[model samples]
Target: MLDNTKRQDIKVILQQVWGYEDFRYPQAEIINCLLNKQDTLVIMPTGGGKSLCFQLPALLQPGLTIVVSPLVALMENQVQQLQQKKIAAGLIHSQQAKSDRKLIISNLTQLKLLYVAPETLLTPPIWEKLLQPDLMINNLIIDEAHCIVQWGTTFRSSYTRLGVIRDALHKHKQNKITIAAFTATADTLTQQTIIKTLRLKKQFKKFVINPYRSNLQLKVKTVWTAKGRKKATLKFIQQQHNKSGLIYVRSRKASELLAKWLREQKLNTVAYHGGIINSKRRAIEQDWLTGKLPFVICTCAFGMGIDKSDCRWILHYHTPELLPEYLQEIGRSGRDNKPAIALALISEPTGWLDNEDKQRSQFFTNQLAKQSKQAKKVFEILPSQGNILDIIKEIPDSELALGILQNLDLIQWQDIFNYQKKSSNKNINSVSTSQQTKQMQQFLQTKQCRWQYILSAFSFIKEAKDFKCSKCDRCSLEKPSRIISNK
Candidate 1:
């Protein structure tokens, strides 16, 4: 519990800094836990005010807060927002100039908040700098904590090595550093992975808020062909003209194609994906934020850490490969407490397109499994220290393999993309990727209310009886369906 003086101080800061009169549900309690130097895991939906849970506590604490984030854009956005509040904050990413990065590093002791990508933080220069005697890092925050589980094994192995960082920091500072992890989506498996991989303390506080948003209407439409899929999407866009929204596709090419098609229809739109340069990505985000671009066709890379509150709709041109991803994407809408719609356009199975999605899922799983073997082989032959280019000759996937080995403590990175082998002969498994894919496929075909199905899948049960969210297509008979003909 917060004492009267501390509570009063929190209120003053809330009003002065963020202009919020009071804390949202559970925010105050979360802050109190952190103030008392407790480790905590916060599972709140996007737009549920998770940032304040850590930000306010950092302000109240005595030392600096290190935030580990996944994307460069996310870190930059956060640092800019904190700076706007007159807080001393900075970020280190690949795009920053050498002089700018050095200045930021030298000023770390004075900063209230520092956001960094895991890959950059684990490198020698930054890690060594953080361990210096001058800086006092009181809190270690993992934002989008689900990535630690979802990407730890395959996509970004840097996340899996965070537990080692905590241990190293403890040894260097001679004190236990408090940690707080926050994410919008995580199932039982993902949660367990986060706990075990991060090696969080046993007494760490856990908060799992139900991710139900009554203001967001969820629906799915089935189209029989590629042309039909396009027509259905266009119809939705036509109906919602001039309203700001997002269209999520599965690939960069698709995003570009969709954006081009929408442009031909005389709608203001843009394409966003990893393939776009950082400066252009920043511009597109700004355009969307300022209502210049009414809609953006993008891959899953678009919405993390973006705080656009008035987004009225989100259309999924292709269903995501996981339920957690689907939830995270749609959660971006209705942040301002206004009504919004989340619609997915799915293609009905035709002889030509049958099992296309399932095949894609299996192909990705097979690739991950193959990478595990490659990682083991590379581990066998890697030198005590070497350049990345040399190792890539022996194993084409050495970059990802090195990350996996580093997480297992079999290797230590010396500089950016360079590693030294610490031990040898470790076995790694690609955990249940296929199962996750199947779960997503199940979601697309389920007859149950979409929200209820999601709740059940995430192990959040509010009532013993079946509950239907009447806002979804399955439960609402009043909502009309739009089917585009194959012709």
Candidate 2:
């Protein structure tokens, strides 16, 4: 009756079920990319309606949407959200009860979307099962697709097997299945890896949103001791307790200790980190989801699959190993489109992790050179732009070297990206590239506006412009304990 003949089922689902009347920016574009049957790589920033790009298309397309997620927490968050809308979303992860898993798979023949960990997707049995042509998996969606590319610092070994899974899925396609890859963070180097790692065709469709949020205030402070970190962290959280906030640390033990210490000061706080038992973590997540918890202190393990759209503040206790990781952390805050604050708690951390940073550049450079056998020598010429072939003569296969370069995040290609070989050069510039990496290291080392630099790396330039935010550490060094009682 409503021109159902040509109207997409997703438009109906969004209106009738999810209670939405419109799609966000890039949602329609990503859905169209899938409808056209092209492999796509999406780089929409956080809170930028990434889910609809896959969900709407999966509903419109013929078969199941098999999603490869990086975190178990994300799987839970997405599954619950879908179920709330009465959409048929299922999950396959280690945490699913065996009976539940069987039921989901049995009903999977009609499943609109099925989410699974990439690690689970790589198993031999799973590979065999996905090979069935009649099984009807029309879409392959890899969330956090950056993990597969080398450009992302938080690389997971599971992502490497996507190529294997892709090849197998293609072997039995009765109807062409479209692969959609999505992530929030990627430099030029990572943009290339998303397509290459998934083993998609060289000419993949791309949707890249400039990573910028003008509503957030960015700040960085350099402190020398753990006590300084706690004093500063507590002060900030108290000021904004009326709104949502998150504090991140490196260790699980640190998360628990900090949570306990904060509550001792009589704050409405809870802990969320990987070291907690799964049941406890779920409870914490649920509590936060229901708005029962006002603030949380966590580790890097948090926020992977979170859908909370109300966080107003995020703090980083220390800088991470890579820019991609930093992007993921900051992305968690301000999902509601309101003004928020992001803080990086910087200090010269001692121990092995520090030493690892000192040599990490050389470590990755040598690894990439080996992988890009022919391109090894050609990487030396700085600021010299050339084709992939000119560069790949030293490191022949465009595929392998691209994979290695993607991991290192050295260079990104033009839109409609192809892994080309570059011209010959005198040497590789591992040191210079590593020096650029020091931008992140110096972020920790410097006392400047850390937020501006972090946001800019992902190309969020205007958000950092129009200076004098007046809300950062640089704005209030001697201010009183406004942390509490202000909000």
Per-residue lDDT of candidate 1, residues 294-379 (tens digit): 88999989988899999999999888877889999998888997999999977665526544454556667787778778777777
Per-residue lDDT for 457 in model 1?
83
Per-residue alpha-carbon lDDT of candidate 2 for residues 341-422, written as tens digits (9 for 90 to 100): 8888665456332342335445555654454553343344423445443444644354344434444444444311222334
Please report, as a residue range, the 10-residue window in candidate 2 with the lowest summed lDDT.
478-487
- The lDDT, on a scale of 0 to 1, for candidate 1 is 0.82
Residue ranges of candidate 1 with Cα displaced over 4 Å: 350-359, 379-396, 402-430, 478-487
Best candidate, lDDT: 1
The list of candidate 2 runs beyond 4 A from truth reads 1-10, 150-155, 348-437, 444-456, 459-487
Please give the lDDT score at residue 316 for candidate 1.
91
